[model samples]
Target chain A: MASNTSDLRSPLARARGLGSAKDGTEHWWGQRLSAMALVPLTIWFVFGVIRHLGADYTAFHAWMKSPFSAVMMILTAVVTFHHAHAGLQVVIEDYVHVEWQKLALLIAVKFLSFALAAACVLAVAKIFIGA
Target chain B: MANGSGRPLSPHLQVYKLPLTAILSITHRITGVGLAVGTLLLTWWLVAAAVSPEAFARAQGFIGSGFGLLLMFGWSAALYYHLCNGIRHLVWDAGKSFELSDADRNNRIVLGAAAALTVLTWIVGLAVW
Candidate 1:
């Protein structure tokens, strides 16, 4: 019976494919990709911010309405938020060991980031379209 | 494993000596959080700019203040730090930094580049004004 038990367990475990948490590589890759995307986007963003330094509303509107600035602004928002989501995801996984809390935080981060990214894109679209 | 079997092991952070790489690791995390918060500020500015002249004025007023400028400066520094450190990580990922000396050199490079970038950004910012 003991031999049979061992044999049964071995096959079941092998079949189940139970293993160490293997999802980390995906998160790591995601963070890296987002970081890479942010490099150019961030440089553009910094320049955009600097240009707005002393400008008033009229200047701000004209800047955002420009095609190149509008496109870069949209890219910056999307990439920045995506990168933020990836980073915060890892943070939650690292510190929040409680299963339920970790799940909730992960979901909340995803939802909030998506909402912000979408809002920024829409706002930019509206500006370009004069809506 | 045999000694003090019932007691739990001390946490990782408390147990380890803080090395340069470890410090950079934590700073990477810190700057990431900072960038996330700063992104919200950017979003607010974009929304205001898109909405109306009054809204844009409000954003400009807040951003032009001393405190706002300070926060912006900090955000820019965080962005540059995270960028440099992230590239360091990518290099490490490609299996180039196994040697202790190489790791130390890369750490120094990342730190120095981040500082230089921050200074240059501020210089340009001030020049713009």
Candidate 2:
């Protein structure tokens, strides 16, 4: 009963999230998980590209129509870009000196990454679903 | 943590001779950035394929151009390096290969693997089509 009254930590301190300034471990682990997933997917992708070298749109369209390849492509796009954004944020935080410039770049990178991912997903869907 | 004392702001890169581990660590970040850029090109190719054969051809033509091919080659090199170094990093994450000797050997292996993989992939690409 006395321990409750004697506790010194403020509510703000008690409620503080985690890791360097309340958040980071999760982001760190996110990069690791995504990287692990990408290892096989990237290898598969490289081989797939090699197999399709010089093949025209018709060939690609045909190959991507398979639910398996289409799904893998989508997953790769999402995880890779998310991982890229996370890594790039740290790079900018480390290097970019000007506050506005860093903020602008961080925003731009996220926008481009997410936009590309969305477009890739839609494209894969269009081909996979024949829509 | 800050007083107006004449203190070093940060460690200068030029002062110290970087070891292979440090060099590869920096390369990891550089390739990470390069891959982010390379994804845009991949995205374009994918969208064009999704659009029409003509559009895809146009995309292919650009990518097949000499300059475009060079860029793609560089991108591929970055990709291979990043992926290889990434695996090395994951191994470190498992709390292995932390010794300086291990760092030296493993980092060199990562570089060699990246180079070999890049060249091999291109060769396979050329032979296939």
Candidate 3:
């Protein structure tokens, strides 16, 4: 009977590997969390952009000089990039079946996201600090 | 016995009715892709601002042109849609909205809020300009 197959395996073997893939939940949860963080942050950033629309360079600098706006902008940039990375990672994972290509893309996305986020934060800091 | 080869499967799109949820899901992917490209625009804007007034003006000119404005508007819409739907996903992640009625209600709310936010952003842009 087919029951013999189940009985042949150790209990540890049967219980240890019942899932599709390990550590997949982290990706799922991070994507969800970053998305959640982006909700209010994106809304705030949109209004911030609108408030600065038509502003001259000096005015734009002044607007970003505000501590609160600067902080929010940095946070928005980081969170948005992180959210984008998570979204794109899933897209790559689903569609890019080539092993090396997928791995390279995943790494490239992380690098770009981090670099952009860092640049945004530095720009915000410089704007605020007059550096 | 002679055997017959099976008929080719009909294409899925012919049979698949485009549902609201399906449409929204596809739009979410489109907006995600759009936003990814739009990030380059944001990076350019920031870098220009950081560089010099001349550079900033150049960036502004690009962003102010007809095509640029159209792209900006699209980006704004994408941003709003992604945001609202993202919140919807968050709620779903929390194990809520499993009921059909609640799911429908949440979908409507997401769509409506995205529209409202996009309109509001455009209005604010118009007012500013």
TM-score of chain A, all candidates: 0.78, 0.84, 0.80
lDDT of 3 by residue, A23-119 (tens): 4467677878777777778778777777876566788788788889888888888877888888888888989999999999999998998898888
Q: Which candidate is the best by lDDT?
A: 2
Query: Which of candidates 1 and 3 reaches a greater lDDT?
Result: 1
DockQ of all models, two decimals each = 0.70, 0.74, 0.54
Please say which candidate is ahead in TM-score: 1 or 3. 1
Q: lDDT by residue for model 1 over A1-131, one digit each (tens)?
A: 35565564556555665545734357677778877888888888878888779698778778878899889988888888888998899899999999999999999999999998988998888888888
On residues A1-131, what C-alpha lDDT tens digit does candidate 2 reach at each position? 33676756566655664534666478889999999999999988888777776679879988899989999999988998999899999999999999999999999998988999999999999999998
- lDDT tens digits, residue span B1-129, model 1: 435588776547776778988889899999898889887877788788778888878888888899988998898888899989888877878888879998889889999999999999889889988
Interface RMSD of each: 1.2, 0.9, 1.4
Best by TM-score: 2
In Å, residue A21's CA in model 2 sits off its true spot by: 3.6
- TM-score result, candidate 2: 0.87
Query: For candidate 1, what is the TM-score?
Result: 0.84
Better of 1 and 2 by lDDT: 2
Residue-level lDDT tens digits of model 2 in B10-54: 655788777778888998998898898888888998999999999
lDDT of 3: 0.81
TM-score per prediction, in order, is 0.84, 0.87, 0.83
